[model samples]
Target chain A: MDGTRDIEALIEMMARLPGLGPRSARRAVLQMIRKRGQLLAPLAEQMSKVAATARECLRCGNVCTSDLCEICLSDKRATGEICVVQDVGDLWAMERGGAFAGRYHVLGGTLSALDDIGPEDLRIPQLVTRVREEGVSEVILALNATVDGQTTAHYIADQLEGQVRLTSLAQGVPIGGELDYLDDGTISAALRARKSI
Target chain B: MDGTRDIEALIEMMARLPGLGPRSARRAVLQMIRKRGQLLAPLAEQMSKVAATARECLRCGNVCTSDLCEICLSDKRATGEICVVQDVGDLWAMERGGAFAGRYHVLGGTLSALDDIGPEDLRIPQLVTRVREEGVSEVILALNATVDGQTTAHYIADQLEGQVRLTSLAQGVPIGGELDYLDDGTISAALRARKSI
Candidate 1:
């Protein structure tokens, strides 16, 4: 109502953001308005700039402003190790930790037969090509601990079985989390992935 | 740490987002890269368009693209009711619900002695002027439930005590929430605001 149409439009757009809804979107918009100069303006400017320049690395399937992504072009990054992940969110998680000096291979999505998903739908073929072309020696599957995620990981591992070394993230207690509160799947995974201490 | 300086810069900027840290920022970047045409391009276009046009509503503190926000120019929205909030987020939240049929007044921030914020620092003066100039009969305080928020609300109430009818959101359980899981403050507020059966 009133002259809130623009604000409303903003809220609608923000609602589409991950982990936000109409309520949170509205709150975020209001905060942006209140801090027009400090927070909102800078954010808007940066967002626009990135929007204009953003493009994918044609070879590595990584985000970049140019034809080649940072990972693909970086000569220092370990060429023999390729960390595979289910989604971009997972890739980002890896980057935040500042670990894994190797380059990444993002499998856009996991194999979901129920949803009619296949290897072609994901970047499975591209991943295989990258392995051979880049002379990868190790392939680390960092998929989520979900059913579909594990299934996809197994499928990838089977495909690359004789070609390279396959490994996964260590399962057990999360660094800042408790074990008693762990779900059935986590508990089972932890038990199965028990390492030699 | 890679060749895509622009992408790195974008990721760094994105990491500063409210809920997104470095990790989430990375995943988001990767996703945008993989879905270059469907999700990334359109999002980038919209971001640029909004960045070019976005501005604060001179009258009501809402965000808009024009000199006069759509709400302030609409003749049908002169409902004499003004919803006053501590931030633009609250205003946007209200707009998202698409319920309230009145205008909004954004008070940049709440009065906070700890942070050295005072009435002059906020838009209290503008609010007073708007009340008198806009023929407003009622003012709704939609500030947060925090100590600073309440303090600011009381201050506003005292300022316009004799001039206009003032009300606030009813305190109670939120929709689709378990009362037992609510904090003590919420429970107390709900108890104190109990209505006659």
Candidate 2:
């Protein structure tokens, strides 16, 4: 118990992470101590490096080491299209899918009237400016299927209406998703948007 | 993506911790980055401190900053009774229970014939020396009920049979455990060890 105080403080800080709790944090700290040279030192070094350098992209709100993110700076990504997302996590998810070859505009959060968050609070204004200034011909709303996500998408659509071809991700039974497990709203939407083969 | 390489490395290291996977690690890293000043920086500082200070207590094999653990140095603990456990985690578990006021002897691990682990591989010789020199009256083998745990317990018992009183933990229905949910082995043990009201 001589050094438990410092270890306990480390556990407490680790417990504040998204997926870790007190018990897991304690185990993690113990393991880190056990592999101090291999894990703890390198992890601490990486965390410090990230804390010192990591910043949001000025253009698209993506996390980056510089003023602009890699995706925002890359000339290979299509300038004609801009995909709108709720946050950096969503942008990463889209990139992992590897379907889209365009630039992304991370809104940082949804429009929540209950929480008093407005369009201006998000990156909506920045998105509109990008659409106009960058000669974007299409704007894709790839926001989540939540109520707040839909509301935010609708607001962005209104902001950029007629200026570009506004589109949204199609809602239906996901590939490999079971019809029996599908929700009523999804079933209804899928039925209404049915296309003939 | 520019800063993601460092972030990904952090995630990989985090995923190596017990009870965490790659997805959870990614989520944790993102949350930490988002709260860099409040969480990431402090966590890094704590980790570095722990890494620099934490070491195994020479006397008890418990993690501590000094040469001996707090419990080993405490005069309040009953040196007459030695509770032998499998590892530091098991010692911590017993400490959490707060039932035994005696000091602990951590064996580190059980004797595994398949793994070529013997008495020399564990702290058995040190435990024997403590029992002889410390004037210990009782030696409690509070080891796990696994085959290897019982094997190690029996081995230790053989070494210290004539010198001190030897005992092991009772095996029966756990507190708040239901008979319907209990295993046959436990039910049989409980019946055999039944006491008179």
Root-mean-square deviation per candidate: 4.4, 2.2
- Model 2: residues >4 Å from true position, as ranges? B114-116
Question: Chain A of model 2, TM-score against the native?
Answer: 0.95
lDDT of 1 by residue, B1-197 (tens): 33356566666765665666776666565555455565555555454445456677788876677776676777877899889887666775687788888888888889999999999888898889888888999999999988899999999999999889999988888988798799988888889988899
Q: Which number leads on TM-score?
A: 2
Q: TM-score of A-chain in each prediction?
A: 0.89, 0.95
DockQ of each: 0.28, 0.70
The lDDT of each candidate is 0.75, 0.89
Give per-residue CA lDDT, model 2, range B10-94, as digits (tens).
8899899988998888788888888888988888888888888888888778888999888888899855999999987788889
* Candidate 2 chain B: 10-residue stretch with minimal lDDT: B1-10
lDDT value, residue B22 of candidate 2 = 86
**Residue B98 error, candidate 2, Å:** 1.9
Global lDDT of model 2: 0.89
